[model samples]
Target: MGFDEKAQNKAQEFQGKAKEFVGDKTGDENLQADGAADQAESGAKKAAENVKDAAKNLKDGLTGN
Candidate 1:
């Protein structure tokens, strides 16, 4: 994935971790769930980007790039 996309995903993942930590310390179930969802979304985005990169690499290889 591109640098911008990777950085954004990392930021999101970090934010989620922070949220989870705060929620756990404060005993906020909803916030904890939200944090988990955010982390999952970030993970999904990263996975999709990885797949796209892999496909691009495969195409470039076949084309002798």
Candidate 2:
């Protein structure tokens, strides 16, 4: 919902992508799984933030913010 949170999520997603790439190249299944999990977690967090933002927007609109 904020710049800092968005930046952190983007960083985490990027890190996950790098890990996944390295794991695939080196044939490390565990690392690959970890990377996938990280990506999923980032995605979930982003989604939650989006929902919160939408709710806030709706409330603000109703209250004439």
Candidate 3:
């Protein structure tokens, strides 16, 4: 987990919202699906980052760094 990954995940989440809105407005099922997928991925990414950060913290603690 790092700043860049966090920012990218945030950006992805926003973009997915835009896509979902546009899809709803235009009645595009594919776009809506894509947006949903994007949102899911973004959520997963953030979760992964959190896990990584926690692991890093544990490592640093053991190593005294």
Tell me the TM-score of each prediction against the true structure.
Answer: 0.90, 0.90, 0.79
Clashes of each: 0, 0, 0
**Lowest lDDT block of 10, candidate 1:** 1-10
Give Cα-based local distance difference scores for all models.
Answer: 0.92, 0.92, 0.91
- Candidate 3 lDDT over 1-65, as tens digits, reads 56887798899999999999899999999999999899999999888878988999999999999
- Of the two candidates 1 and 3, the one with more favorable TM-score, higher being better, is 1
Better of 2 and 3 by lDDT: 2
lDDT of 2 by residue, 1-65 (tens): 67997899999999999889999999999889888988999999989988998999999999999
By summed lDDT, the worst window of 10 consecutive residues in model 3 runs over 1-10
Looking at model 1, how many pairs of residues clash?
0
- Model 3, residue 13: displacement in angstroms? 1.1
Write out the backbone clash pairs for model 3.
none
